[model samples]
Target: MHLPFWLTTALLFPVLLYQGKRARKHTPRLPEAQGSPCGQYGEGTPDIRFLVLGESTAAGVGASRHEQGLASQLALQLRERTGQTIAWHTFGVNGIRMGQLNQILASMELPQADVVLLSMGVNDTTGFTPRHRFRRQLLALREMLAPRYPGPICLLSVPPMHLFTALPSPLRQIMGWRARQLNRVYEQLARHAPGDFQYRSYPAITDVSLLASDGYHPSDKGYRAIAEVLACEDWFPDQPAP
Candidate 1:
């Protein structure tokens, strides 16, 4: 027996919505700036310099192009809001872990930056690296960056891992639970950080459509969501012209 077109569509709606919800559940939502307290930007021509250090997310893995990545979109937004020129540099690798990030920071002679945004941890959590060692290395890296960069040092919380929530049933539950645990660890580490460091908890981008086909990184919409959060918080005072 053949099914009516409308009936088939109607029947599929719930399943589709369920799948969408599940996809979103595993994805990270864009963070609200509610918990982040407002801070003053030092006077004079805001010497806005940004150094982004992290893994695939920072490198714009799921994005279609470089300009669509988190860094670029953030730069554009900052410029529009603060009306200050931003000098931004990005040091990202496809699958870098915390230890590797530390080593990279140590070996290279980086340009003096007023702001530093660290976007690591996801790979470390999902990758083979042990959590304890990863946390230690991250803390060390934080200490290292704090002293060197005079301005605000921010840590972008790991976006939700789609792999967990998007999986089938039992595996999804297990992965989702683990993702939350890791996120908590990240928050705790941020709280324990020394010096003028800020932790920005961005909501996990949940829309699967916002993710690239690989289902790992942010799509343009996801990146824009991140930029909106940063812009709302006035993270970058010296933004360049769009």
Candidate 2:
């Protein structure tokens, strides 16, 4: 069954962003320092390199600029809390799926990160990607990341995909069901992964104002909420109340 045009576009958004990078000269570059409240846990030592990989949300799509994305804010928070620097890298494209992410990882030269945060699944469901494929790709990704970093690897749950609300009721129901199933897959994986690999699930904010103009991606406030959850994780401790 073919997904509708908007769903397809949403699924393919990351790829379009990646392809159009040179054309969008206006898009700001990712920040240099990588530490944030959640990101500071890994830095400097063999135990501190931080890498965030996934879709546009991981890339900070709705924010005004790249520096305002989730990865950048997390990095800044880490630096302030830890008094140590963290190097963050993002490999997120707008419409990327798990299979494509696997390919991306294979081709790219990633830093030796102590912590790896993956924000994905939203695109997969939106694209109607097969559940089997999603599971296989994610497992493969874990294997690839585990031997190298051996630290905390968190898989963020998919934020609620309410963009389809504007569609007919039937389509909306189908899309919502698909999205929930994807989130369940993520939740299950996080529960089962060995070692420090963890799953972090946050309630999806439904306030339309928190979303970008596209009515899909998270706005700055949305990204900030995501950062806050990561910060509270035991892996990424909060600074003492000032």
Q: Please give the lDDT score for candidate 1.
A: 0.63
Q: Give, for candidate 1, the lowest lDDT window spanning 10 residues.
A: 31-40
Tens-digit lDDT track of model 1 for 192-214: 75354577777677767776654
TM-score of each candidate structure, all chains considered together: 0.70, 0.73
- Local error of candidate 1 at 148, Å? 2.3
Across residues 1-242, which tens digit of lDDT does each residue of candidate 2 receive? 23564475567566644533532353343322222322333456523456788887766677766556677667666665566666666667777888998988887777666678898887787577877788888888887877787765688877665444333344445556677777777777777764645787777667777766555567787777667666655555534442
Off by over 4 Å in 1: 1-46, 162-166, 194-196, 236-242
Please list the Cα RMSD from the true structure of every candidate, rounded to 1 decimal place: 12.3, 7.6
